[model samples]
Target: MRAPEREYDSDPASHAHSQTRTLSSSPPPKTNGYVANGHGSPINGSSKHLKSPVARVELPGSTIYDDSYIDREEYIRLVIQSLRDIGYIESAATLEAESGYVMETSRVAEFRRCILDGTWSEAEGALGHLGVGEDDGLWEAKFLISQQKYLEYLEMGKITMALHVLRNELAPLHMDPELLHPLSSLIMCTDSADLRQKAGWDGAHGSSRRRLLVNLQSYIPSSLMIPPRRFVTLLDQARLHQISHCIYHNAPVTPQHFSLYADHTCDTDLFPRITTTILQVHTDEVWSLEWSHNGKFLASASKDKSVIVWSVGPNSNPDIYVHLHLQDHQFPVGCLAWSLDDTILLSSCEQLIKMWNTESGALIRTIEAHTEPVSALAWVPDGSGFISASQDRKINLWGSDGKQRDSWGITATRIIDLAVTPDYTRLVAIGESAKDPILPPPRSDATAASGANRNGNNNTATSSPRTLEYLMIVYDLTTKQPELSVSLGGQLTSVKISSDSQYALVNHAPDEIHLWDLFTGRLARKYTGQRQGRHIIRSCFGGVDGNFVVSGSEDGNVYVWHRDRAILLDVLTGHGSGSVNSVAWNPRNTQMFASCSDDCTIRLWEPSAGDRDGDSSTRLAHRTADDRSHEGEPNVKGKGRSRESWVEDDSASRSL
Candidate 1:
């Protein structure tokens, strides 16, 4: 016998109060002799009422309740519907009974059961009863159902019935001829295996029926069954749309953020892999390399007295090749720089700087301003001009027309390297500082006078030391005046400023690199473990937020270290017979980086495919542990905050 349908009160507040009253230890309140119903209606025609039950509703920590947006009953209905749509039938039934919500009607359950039982006539009637419209979706669903029934008849060796079903049912649906032709051919098969081979159906009763039901749900309106994965699919589309429009999205969107509705299965298998491309056109040592701002091309200068422009393909595959080669420089090219617009290329040879048109490889301008070998070159932020430092103890600013605009001389010491901030507000130059003359001891005035008279008339004499001290000077670009000067012990080979201009990466001779805080002029951290004595090994700041420092080594390997913690991360090797001269990371594509070496080849490095399967959190934890292991012994002495103390201590230790 059919059970009577249960009735529920629509008043959520009264229902909740009744549940809550059961949990509390309080006496019933009454005004008259009669009690009141849970809905605030007086019973027995009296104005008095007993207390209602109180409900203990435990909300999630992150939930904020708003009755105006959604009422208690509506929220519970949504939950129940979601549970049933995802195939959690048992849970949905339990929730429906407890919450007094009926999400799935008897007709919907009957339709599902008919499909699973292979009762084609009942399923069709059920679909029609569910209000499926006479649209293309309806016809397409009917065709699939007819085709499945035809296959079932053939599988049971009833050839005559299979032909009758196909010719009458499937043909009347007006499906495309391509689909109809395949269904008509299924009747010629003798056995289930033959039918499965001809028509790509598995001939499985349960799985095939389940798939047909899923397909039919797509045709039926969501008001009937709430199309499977409807909430999840809509949420995914919204997230992708937002990510595509976001201005600051650096990585792909993942299912780790807050969402109203989401599927918990997230594929976190995104990582780059290395290709097999190695540029071997240069016949001599490659001294320096730089990427275009747009990351379309790579310019490499070598000791072969040539600069080769490699065209970087969009796919970043193993097909990058040389685009242009400029061989105008008579001496070996030492440094390279691209203009802000990436149209002009600058290559520095000893005492000369040549400008070439990047597109045509034509020599546009040549400036011969330095008296000695030019050691460093930096373009102004606006690309209006450039600055060149040389061993002649001079620094000159030149325009694009090859004319010197300004020139300044240091205190008789060769300039080693220079770097300008991204904003062009400050310029830092590293060079040797002038030394004070050594005077004879004051204890021998007579001996000093006798020696002076023997040399000249009667003047005291002094001698100067052979070696000068190395120092770094910061200059105000607007005023062209020295701002701060600090002494350094070892010779500085290369200098790079962070993108934010907060710190400077300075490479010292032999093997050490120091990170200096620009605002305070204090040493922030130090990186080691690279052999840098023989060549000018250039290092750069990379990673998503410039969290890593990548540099070349004389040991024929590329070394990477954490910028803040100074922990060595990777030591990549493949440079055949010489030291790695420079490493350049793609400004746009952070996954790929290139390293050029004295072996006259450029090698590309990327993450292995195996790394993609590893969890991102695990990789980060490993990196942090490595940093801790390397943090025990400080490379720089004294945790000094003052500039003087830090520099002086570092200089003294290096001198020892």
Candidate 2:
């Protein structure tokens, strides 16, 4: 797979050293006999100060930076801990002394020492002084200490002492009975070796005591006991924030690739703009698309009543091919859903939903529950069942065998699309209260025949004022009941929930995608830039952490926006004159994405050659050769474009 663009000075080791340059050269800023108030803002004359003696020397009157969020003493202590963690023992001690900010309180330090020495009673006694109140926190700490004490007694073959600790000490703590049952069984051990093996303990003399200390620290506040590797944790959080905010961050982050010398930002070229391959198995406009959970296969439903599952290559070659061509549906396929295991697929053709074995392309079963056209399909997270929404105003739950399990509910309007959250907590659907005036409504067989016989008097040919009342209904999947309903105004196309289940992106006509916060049940933001006043244009959540939103536009361009900021980042153009219908990003491969269009093709995309690794020349040459090899072949079912069209790079016109 292709990697993102990186700076020339990419030596992480050099960057690591550079990050510490300021730290190694400067001592903590000396306090001027002043300290921060309760709010951490500096006050005159030491109104408040840290418990550490080092705090008197090094902690500034204010935060580390003038506008810094962290308190001054806390920052110093974190630095001191960081210094100790990186083998700067003397430096850590010096900073602790100069800063007057002890990494831990004397009582907390003694608590750590007692735990490490296996002096269980002293450790247990020190818990109160370490600032853990007499509550569940205190009880939990005592339980941990007593548990360790009992385990050590067992390890030393002191069965009677172990029994006494377990019954009198651990039992009296009123802890979970489940926790004590296992310890009670340790009494039957033949010897210390048996006890250690069965308990999965390395013994009290090993790292057990130290591990206990770490566990006990959770009950103590940071002010009393510094969290281990506090400095490293802070840096990691900062780096993660940067990566999440970087609009073009597509590559996996690693120690070798991540650097603290500068904030992380990837080049726009890494956002999968360049079209690398064209899939032409479908004979008509590709209407729907979905990537299997594993990203190994991409399934596209087309207007020709066919579904094509394209097998994606492994990372090294990064190629794609036709894996299965299912032509069983007699009507145009509208939507698709892949089972969590990627072994089963559900494709909807009008009112009938067909389940197929993805591997063999055999129709498993056909579901005939929906009376109207099935608008969308979503599989339950466990893959044991699936959900089908229809214009019949009902959502039905079905088992893997295609038997209807239950109906969510009948809404008052037509359901356009629906999605179950990743956590399986809620089901969100886009419903329109009335037929949209701008778009033609679906007609039944009888209605179509009557309209055909009515000559020019058919009401279907008339246009009216737009009066679509778009709304989203959120259902509690567990109870199969509506939890929240949000009324929106638009010609709704589709809806996709974020991986976190916190936000839903609802595609709307007249060129907009409204992002709704599920928790607040409100519209959070609107993303626009692509033309989607008409036609069904589908958008998706993609990129790292699903931080980017991508959509197809009637203007024949793929629009990308940062999900959080509602900022348009890139407009990718490569499809022919037809409107881009839908887009899907490879869930497992962040560097690759696919866009299907009314042009009767699906285009695979990746980072530009300049920003990526591999033999691009050879890859492109192979693709050109592949396209040429299909020349002169019959264009099946009016697929429109010839195979030779794939070799021509029209990106120059499509790209900005």
TM-score of each: 0.51, 0.68
Runs with alpha carbons beyond 4 Å of true place in candidate 1: 1-275, 411-413, 434-465, 609-656
Residues 1-656, candidate 1: write the lDDT tens digits. Answer: 01012222121213321222122222212111111111111122111122232222334322236435544544554565565455554454444444433443456556776777788998887777776878637777788788889888888888889889887898887778998887777777877899988887878454787778778887876544545455456667877665444322234344454355753322222222242246676787888889988888998888788898877644333224456778887677877888888988888877788988888778898888765567788888888988888756788898876688987755335577788999788988876544644422332343442222111111133353345567778888888788888788876777889999888888877589888888998989999999876467788987555767889888998888867667786677667777887888888776667888877788766554343334323433443221332222221132111011111122111110
Q: After superposition, how far is residue 380 of candidate 2 from its true place, in Å?
A: 1.1
Reference-based lDDT, residue 154, model 2: 81
Q: 468-581 in candidate 2: lDDT tens per residue?
A: 577788989888778998777667788999999999999987778999999898889999899876577789999867988999998899998988888888888768888898
Top-scoring candidate (TM-score): 2
Error of 2 at 238 (Å): 2.2
Candidate 2's clash total is 8
